[model samples]
Target: MSWPGGYGRRVLAEVDSTNAEAARLADTLAGPEWICALRQTAARGRRGRPWANPPGNFAATLVFRPEGDARQVALRSFVAALALYDALASLTRAEAALSLKWPNDVLLSGGKVAGILLEYPAGPGGPLAIGVGVNLIAAPGAEAVEPGAVPPVSVLAETGVRLSPEGVLDALAEAYARHEGALVTYGFGPIREAWLARAARVGEVITARTGREERRGTFETVDDDGNLVLKTAEGRVRIAAADVFF
Candidate 1:
């Protein structure tokens, strides 16, 4: 349960949202910090969707002052995704069962197992906060998910391996540090390659809904800038953000 050198850790009995806490602490952080909450009363996911965190599930946020523009900083989502894939592979030894969904979701046996939500920065070089939530012990009921959204699964439910929030954080923090280091040193070339290797539905037909525009296409590859590249009936499309469906 050790973080890599220089990373900070904080654990609380409860929090409204780790991302919210990170926002409050972002300005004062001297270095990267991982904050974990055993219970989140008001947790949330991307686009302000509600995130359910059961007692033993994992909910944490990593806050840091990153040196880069929004484009460069946005690449950390892929970094985090790869780190999550590695952490889960090590924890469950089910590397074959894990896959990285484009943008920010982790799929286990095709079920949504974890999610990443990066807070939109206030400016070019503003501090960044990345919120991650994993279903470790219990997943919310399938009925809780929106129509067409992937149903959730927990590590215990899927792998029969129960774990505490702290244990998951230990693995995640270390994994994140490793990928983040590569991003800082090698730029996104290596990270992109690594992420694409684990990516889901690269050659399959999928639907991407960004706002009111719904585009259907064969999933191509994530571009260097992290856009979703799709081969559509109209033509090649590069989407910066979208809700993908298969």
Candidate 2:
């Protein structure tokens, strides 16, 4: 269940459902870098929708039991996004164009390249897990996406980057270490700066989706509380958890 060195415990070589397995382990087995990976897992996006986690694609969960509050735990999504951005940067020349959509979706040239899902226990002071899925190769079909939802893309085999899922995992963990230090010191501000530096153009009209509600508006910047600011025709709005499309 454990790998040598700082590498996480590899639960199985499943073709489906890494998140489910990791979620089960979060209560008992997960420590720092307690990982569960799947060669192929079902894609469930932010709003209870299916994602495409095909073979050769990246589907894994990185569990962290930080001694912090919900605020810090929620900030893990941003930290994970930064880690992924750094990993992809090492693999491609189009690194400058990478951006973090609100919440924790990673975007490359306007299409979704990766997503981060944060899962935690209901009560206080419990462990938490983050599920990250990147399109290393092949995207979901139109049937898997909502009618108006934005299309998606992959990194490997498309960005001229030949990366195995393990390679991505390694690079991401290293990147997370660097940002985690900053998180411990200066809080999410410093990490958010790094995220915005790679983000797509803000203040542009786009669609934002939470599980319950959806809206179209101009994208504002992320506030200090990590909430996304949207300038809708209705007014300026803040979304606590939602998938952003720009």
Task: Give lDDT tens digits, candidate 2, residues 177-206.
Answer: 777778998887898787777767575788
**CA displacement after TM-score superposition, residue 3 of candidate 2 (Å):** 10
List the candidate 2 regions with Cα displacement exceeding 4 Å: 1-7, 34-38, 41-43, 121-124, 211-213, 233-235
- The number of the candidate with the highest lDDT is 1
Q: How much is the lDDT of residue 53 in candidate 2?
A: 77
Q: For each candidate, what is the lDDT?
A: 0.90, 0.73
lDDT, candidate 2, at 10: 71
Which predicted model would earn the best TM-score?
1
Backbone clash pairs for candidate 1 read none
Q: What are the RMSD figures for all models against the true structure?
A: 1.2, 3.1
Question: Could you tell me every candidate's TM-score relative to the true structure?
Answer: 0.97, 0.87
- Residue pairs in clash, model 2: 15-40, 43-51
